[model samples]
Target chain A: MKILVCISNVPDTTTKITFSLDGKAFNTAGVQFVINPYDEYALTRAIELKEAQGGSVTVLNVGEADTEPNIRKALAIGADDAIRVNLKPTDAFLVSQQIAHYAQEGGYDLILMGRESIDYNGFQVHGMVGELLGIPTIAPAIKLDVNGSTATLEREIEGGKEIIEASLPLVVSAQQPMAEPRIPNMRGIMTARTKPLKVVEPVGQDAKTSVQNYELPPAKSGVKMIDAENAGDLIKLLRNEAKVL
Target chain B: MSVLVVIECANGEVKKSSLEAASYGSKVAAALGTSATAVAIGDVQANALASLGEQGITKVLLDNDSRLHDFVAAAYVKVISKAAESENSSVIVLSNSNIGAAIGSRLAVKLGASLATNVVALPQINGSSFTVRRGVFSGKALSDVELSSDKKIIAVKKNAVDIETTAGGTATVENFSADLADADFATAPKETIRQSGDILLTEADLVVSGGRGLKGPENWHLIEDLAKTLGAATACSKPVADVGWRPHHEHVGQTGITVSPNLYIAVGISGAIQHLAGVNSSKVIVVINKDPEAPFFKAADYGIVGDATEIVPKLIEAAKALDK
Candidate 1:
């Protein structure tokens, strides 16, 4: 079995979001980048599956050169190789198209990705890729297990989870309960240098969606501390003052 | 061309989010100086279909297929595609839900329409170019995206549009069918195992959620009772699931299920950005934390600085009283 895991480099979860001077782009000043937290579950799960059945895991990302470090980090963790589609991912459609183009020829048995990229939270790429490639997609899957040519997954639904069975050549967007992410060990870090990091020029696809502008949300107001013992007063304030109750 | 809205129904009643989608579609149609039509699927009553007129839907195309009652992605895509084609819809609107996201993408490809999911606002249409603001970075940031395609498909985030009630309105419901083939149910669900909860998180108007601060799984009764009284569903933060205090299915975070109910009450939860990403779309957020400095209060509409043990019971009482 061969697996392809897609990852996105995003700002750390704790970073304060700020926009550029013209409010057209994310301000990168003094920002630290990390692998999208949701994608980590997908990467780790793919590596685990590969280890269990003797296969190769390839990591893919569509981003500029600055995202290479995170791509290498995925290699360090467990991916056998990496592919970088050299372009800025302007929208979910273009990103999904780029990924589908690569997976189209790669003959990957399983294509896995985060349920949604933390940066965009579009939650559309997996379905789009599945649609583009004409394959089945089980999204936001919490449990995934493969047996020979068949893969079983538990997809999260509203009140409960659904157990789905699909063939090998399928797409899965993973969330928690799949596997806990593993940090790179010393041996893994050293071996990462020898791993192949392939950079491919993007196949042309127009980004139907473009960023018009960006703005930071309004700063939160100061805390109005009601006495802890007087909890009822807080409820009253919610009904009368805030009028949200 | 008219705007097309997909209305989902189950057990003979329309889902709340689809009504919100209908209202949203009507506004978009109004913006474009046209009418909005609805395509109804599943076991929906004709009377209920006509009631969509309250949201300004002028006509409803009802497809009463038993196989469509449960979510069959391929059949839904085929039916919706036919509806869009027949109506010559330039824009299609749907709820940003599991069904919507699943079927919307395939329809986008079949119809060659630009697709946007988790959309939080109405489109800013400027001479054929449509732009929408969507929540990103797990509720930590926002992005304004322009859908450049001539045909656009939008999955509106739940609770983003207000549910409007306009009196003395009725829509003409007409029977329609796509003549789906047997192969359309290829990926149909073999079984559906609903959890033992009174209200589903997506359908619930109110939700009572807990986090690691609840200490252990044994204390979940308080949250459950409150939810039972209020007819809300129960949820937990990722940390609770990570620590085995709750099941993984109960986790709500960037990596978990994103829900948008009318009211969300968090008990003993310190708001993590990932967790906030899921529930930030709720209309009203009430945070109850012993710690005065919990980050959840920053986004909460109401905050009570008290122990969950003390506050939750009182809240349940207040809710019970309202029923009387």
Candidate 2:
């Protein structure tokens, strides 16, 4: 089985979001980028599946030159090779098309991706890619396993979960409890330095939507501090003034 | 051309998020000088489907497919796409739930339409171009997206829009069918497990969340009592849920269920950016923690720097007293 894992470079969760270019784009100044948290789960699970099933794992990303460093980081975490789609991923539709094109060409048995990228948070690609490739897509799976061509997964629903079984040549958007994400050791990091890193141009359709402007959430008004000694007063304020209850 | 809304129904009732979607679609239709038509999926009562007219939906298309009793994405896409084409829909609206996101993306590709998810507001029509503001960076900011394609599809975030009801409204329900092939049901879940007797965190109007500060799972009774008093759903931070202190479905954060309840009362929890991302859209936030410097206090509308273990009981008593 040849497994494909998709990753995205997103600002760390703690980064304070800011907009620049007169609110046309996100300001990247001084922001640190990491592999999206959800994608980490996919990457780690793909590696585990490869280790047990005797197959190869390849990492894929859609980004510009600056994202190369993180692509290399994904390789260091034990992917056999990497492919960077040389384009700024603007929308989920276009990105999924690119991924579908590559997956079709690779004839990969299993395709894996994060449920959504933290940057765009467009939880659209998994199903789009599945539809594009005419395959089944199980999203936000918390548990995934391979049992000789059939995969059983625990899919997360709103207030519960569902257990599902699907055959190979399927796509899955995985989340936590799939596997603990692996960090690069010195040996893995050194090996990744020489691994094949291929750069390919975007071979996908045009984006349907574009960002016209960006704005920060309204600055929070200062909070009202209530004394702990008078705990009941907080409930009183909630009922009478806040009126949320 | 009209607006097409997908109303997801399960166990004979429309999901709350779908209700929001219906309202959003109708409002958008009103804005565009058109009417809204709804397509209902899953086994639903006829009266329940027609009741959507209260949300401004004028017509309802009920698929009544037994195969779609559970969520079959492939079949669902075919059903919604058929409804859109039949209505000559220029705009499609859906709730940004899991099913909506899954189907909306596929429809966008299949129809070559501009798609936006996590939308918080209606589209602002500017001649030929329409722009929508959606929550980006997990509620940290909003981005105005321009849909350049002639066809537009929007997935509104749950609880972001208020529901509108038109009194004495009733819709005409029409039986609809796509006659989907068996391949569509191939990915249907083998088993579905639902949390019984617990308020759904995503649809709950009020949520009382706990964290590691609650000490251990055994002490969860404190949190439950507060939730019970306020008739609210219960949630936990990622770490607490990861450590098996709470069920995964009860976890709320960037990686978990992002909620926008009317009232979110967080107790014994430090404000992580991820956790805040889930609930920052809440109308009112109340935080109780022992640490005065807990970051949650900064974002909370009201806060008490005290031991949640001590304050929660008093707050519950105060809540119970309100009935008196």
Candidate 3:
């Protein structure tokens, strides 16, 4: 069972988001990029599944050269190799197409990805790739297990979870509860340098959507504190002053 | 050409998010100066589909496929694609749900349409060009996206559009078939297990969510009782789910389910931007936290700087006193 995990380079959760001077694009200056938190679950789960059954885990990313650090980190965490599609991920469609192009020839038994990228918050790549390849996709799956050729997963739904089973050569977008992310130790970090880092050119697809502009949200007003004992006063303010009630 | 709206149904009724999608699609249809048509999937009754007229839908196309009662992404995409072509729909609308996000992306690729998920507001149509403001940065910011395509698909965020109830309006229900092959059912669910909850997150009028500040799993009963009294659904932040303190289904964040209820009560949540992205669209946000510096207070309409253990009990009492 060979697994391919899709990872994205996104700003750390603690980074303060700001726009460039023209206010048209995200300002990346001085911001540290990390493996998208959601993708970590997918990578970790893939590694675990590979460990249970003898197989290989390959990590894929669509980004510029700056994304190699996180790609190496995924390798250190136990991916057998990595694929870097050398292109700035402009949109979800182009990224999905790049991934699908790779998966088409890789003969991977399973493909895993994060539910959504934290930066763009576009939850479309996994399904788009699945559709392009004409395979099944189980999205936002919380639990995943592999048994020979069949894989079972529990996908999160509105009020419950849906248990689904699919054969090999399927796509799964993983979320929390799938597995705990493992931090890279010294030994793994040393071994990651020797792992193969394959760089491929992107087969571009026209992005149907483009960002017109980006705007920061309105600054929140200062906190209005009331006595803890007078908690009911806050409710009154919500009903009368804010009128949101 | 008409606009097609996919109405998801369960238990003989339409899902609340589907109603919101119907309302959104109708508005899109009105913008295009055409009527909105609906495609119903699953084991939904004809009478229930007719009720979609309240949302300004004129025709409801029913597939009546029992296999579709359980969500199969391949089968659903095929059914929706057939419906869209039959109606000659250039524009499609859906609720930004797990199913919607999964299926909408594929449909957009298949139909060669521009797709936007988590859309919060109506489209700004400047002649033929369509632009929409969507929540980004996990609800910390908004970005205006221009869709430069002839066809467009928009997945409206839950609770972004008000559910309009019109009296005595009924839509014509017509049976349709997609002629799915056995291959379409190849990925069907071998088994299904659904957790029973009083209120669904997408449809609930009120929600009570907990976070790591709730101390541990043992104190969850306080949050549960308040949710029960208010007839609200229970939810949690991503960290709570990551730590195994709560079920992953209850996790609300960029990674979890994005919901917009009338009232959202957060207990012991620190209000991370990722978590706020999922609930920021709620009509009213109430935060109960001991830390005054919790980031959630900034986005919350109402804040109580107190311990959840102390405040939740009082809230349950206050709620119980109100007539159901």
Candidate 4:
């Protein structure tokens, strides 16, 4: 079995978000980049599958050279190799097109990625890639198990979950509870240095949508601290003062 | 060209988010000098279909296929695409739900349309250039995006738009057929497990959440009681879920469910930036913590510095009194 896992390099969760002076681009200075948390679940699950099924797992990223450290980290986590579609990802459409272009020729049995990137939060890439490749795409999958050529998945919906079955050559987007992400140990870190990291030029059209500007959410007002004894008054405040009850 | 709104229903009821989407679509249609048409998915009752007129929808298209009762993305895409093509729709609106995201992306590709999800507001239409504001970076900031395609798809975020009800209006319902093929149902679910006997966290407008300060799962009744009194859903911080004090589904944070409810009440929780990222879009926030300096207070509109165990019961009593 050949499994392909896609990863995105996103800012660390705790970083304060800020845009450039012109507000057209995200400010990157002093920001620590990490593999998107959701993608970590995808990568770990792919590695687990490869370990059980005797297959090779390849990590793919559609980003510029600045994303390499995280790509190499994915290799350290257990991927056999890495492929970087050299480009600065601007939108979901272009990223999906680039992923589809590469996976079409790899003929991998499974393709996986995060449900959504933390930055864009579009949650559109997996479905688009599946449509482009003409395959079944299951998203927000919390549990996955492969048996022979069939894969069983638990996909989360609004208030429930569905147990789904699909054949090989499927696209899936991982959500949390899928797997606890694994960190690179000393041995894995040493081996990752020798792992093949191939960087290829991007093959895709321009992004369908362009950012005009960015604005920070309005600052919240100061809290109205009610005395502990007057806790009941807080209810009145929520219902009348805040008008949210 | 007309605007098409995708209405998601379950057990014969339209979802609250879908209602907001319908309202948003109709306003957009009014701006374009056209009426909004809805394509209904899932098991919807006739009354619910007709009631869409309250949200400014003038017409509803129903496929009435049993296969659609359970969400099959391929079948849904086919149904929606057929509706859009027949109606000559240039703008499509749907809720930024899991199912909506699944269908919107595929539909965008199939129709060669540009798509935007997590949209917070209506498009600022300037001739051929339509720009929309959407939440990005997990509610930390917003970005304006220009969709440069002939056809545009917008997935409205939950609680971003109000559900406007126009009085005493009824939508004309029409039968729609997509001639769905067997292949469309090939990936259909084998079984489904639904949460029972509790309000859904994602759909709730009022939420009461607890954290490690709640002590343990044994003390969860305090959270549940407050939630019950307020008719809200129960949620938890990431640490609570990670330690198995709460189910993962109830976890609300950057890596968990991102909720934009009308009111979010956090008890005994310090607001990490990650946790705040999941809920900063809330219309109002209230924090109850023993520590006065918990970060959540900075983001909250009202706060009480005390042990949640003692404060929650009093608040619950006060809430019940208000109902009386």
The lDDT leader among the candidates is: 4
Query: How far off is residue B128 in model 1, in Å?
Result: 2.2
lDDT of 3 by residue, B139-177 (tens): 767899998878888888877788787888899999999
iRMSD values, candidates in order: 2.3, 1.1, 2.2, 0.7
Lowest summed-lDDT stretch of 10 residues in model 4 chain B?
A: B40-49
DockQ of structure 1 = 0.57
lDDT of 3: 0.86
Comparing 2 with 3 on TM-score, the higher-scoring candidate is: 2
Q: Could you arrange the candidates by TM-score from highest to lowest?
A: 4, 2, 3, 1
Can you write out model 2's per-residue Cα lDDT over A1-245, one digit (the tens) per residue? 89999899999999899888599878899999999999999999999998988899999998898888888898899999989999899988889889999999888989999999887889989988998898889988999998889999998877678899999999999877788888899998898899998999898568888898888887679889999889989889998999877
Per-model TM against the reference: 0.94, 0.98, 0.95, 0.99
For candidate 3, what TM-score does chain B get against the true chain B? Answer: 0.95
Candidate 2 CAPRI assessment class: high
Ranking by DockQ: 4, 2, 3, 1
Off by over 4 Å in 2: none
The candidate that wins on TM-score is: 4
lDDT of model 3 at position A32: 90
- In order of listing, the candidates' clash counts read 0, 0, 0, 0
DockQ of 3: 0.59
Docking class of 4: high
Q: How close is candidate 1 to the true structure, as a TM-score?
A: 0.94
The lDDT, on a scale of 0 to 1, for candidate 1 is 0.84
DockQ of each: 0.57, 0.81, 0.59, 0.91
Q: Distance from true position, residue B94, model 3, in Å?
A: 0.9
RMSD of each: 2.1, 1.2, 2.0, 0.8
